[model samples]
Target: MKYFLAFLIFSQTLLASDDWGQNGHRTVGETAENYLKSRVSKKIDRILNGQSIADASTYADEIKSDRAYDEYKPWHYANIPFDQTYAEAEKNPKGDIVFGIEECISKLKSNKLNKEQEQFYLKMLIHLVGDMHQPLHFGLKEDKGANDFKVKWFYNPTNLHSVWDTKMIESYNMSYTELSASLPELSKSEVQSIKSGTLLDWVEESRALTQEVYNSAEADENLSYRYMYDWFNVAQLQMKKAGIRLAVILNDIYS
Candidate 1:
């Protein structure tokens, strides 16, 4: 078990922002599933061939191993330096999270895609929305979203990107359903406000939060219980936001 865990960590280290690890992505999917309208939920169920959104949420990451999906490598995150807004930052010609997300939304909204394409875009959209909520996913270009921001997570050497992507949520030790059930409740207006923004508006929000995260987490520092305590609430809130915002997008598309 020990050796297997070590190998798992090493494999993950090779991938960047692999998008919130499996649990975090499923939390987003589960939360959105809870909020989905009955009709919209049914539509999604049909499209996914009875797979719950939570089950489908990790498809984008799972495809990473296939060379056919190599073109999607850049779609997991975007880099906009602290000094620049996403609009002012030069876009990746291949695509970034923002571009990927907008493209998915556009494709899903068109209603012209065949069933397979619709399933692919819907699954990707579910995952990317979760990625957009992780502040580090909107990180500085130079560091590749802090994949290079080396740090010690509980004395195990790791980078800032991996810390946020998995360490905190995994240490919390809840399944996605458990975590989703545990999220703080918000009033309807709060949900409305969270869902009110355009995709770019949300990207900017994540960018600002990313700056604060970098300021708080220092390179080479040992992050343990205290670090997790300080940041877990933030992670939970981001999860909630991602889930609600995903429901918002799906509702808009299916309504």
Candidate 2:
């Protein structure tokens, strides 16, 4: 088995995406579900099945779990330069998105990978595809969304980024099955378009949205019930988007 690493931050109440300070992760899970259905296509099914199945059938489950905490990984923040350089940096080995994905792909390709390693790649890919859909994971510019800034999350004290990464996802109170069933379906064209962009473009898209989401909220704001209810709309949008984008990426990879 591969040595699986867990990075979840636990507390009294689970963090729901609706309570998140950022909405970049809104669409991940839903996007992935959409992608999986399309995999029934003979060409992609063969590719997915062709993978070294010396491992087993934990592939989809592993992918979902990997994406569970993807929003909070503290990567990509250290990547992406401030301006024109951001584009150039992606071409370099050290780029945050580049290095992370490369590491994942390398692990997938390594013959030494035990079943555990193969599984890790599957999960990590699922999570990373969602992360890549989140613009903040593309770059944080300065604060990394208040990882450095401390604030009270309603009654609880936490950082801005943590609120978005964990709290929001936990708040929905829906089991993954409930959440999955409630989400809207992605159209074929929608699937194609969301997955069409390069990873760099995904980052750039998120980076652009980040400015608006972050700037709209103030530091030290008290996020209570009312605030969460209002933002739930945003969270739903993000979740749906994630599902669509995830399907796009997975369908392409397995294709």
Which one wins on TM-score? Answer: 1
Off by over 4 Å in 1: 1-17
Instruction: Estimate the overall C-alpha local distance difference test score of candidate 1.
Output: 0.89
- Residue by residue across 45-133, what tens digits does model 1's lDDT show? 99999999998988898778668999987998888878899999898999999889889999999979999999999999999999999
TM-score of each: 0.93, 0.63
lDDT of 2 by residue, 100-195 (tens): 655666665565666655556655554555555444454444665456555567668776666556665567666454555666556778756766
List where candidate 2 sits over 4 angstroms from the true fold: 1-31, 37-85, 89-95, 102-116, 139-142, 184-189
Candidate 1: give the clashing pairs.
none
Please give the TM-score that candidate 2 achieves against the real structure.
0.63
Indicate the TM-score of model 1. 0.93
Error of 2 at 55 (Å): 16
What lDDT score belongs to each candidate, Candidate 1 first? Answer: 0.89, 0.51
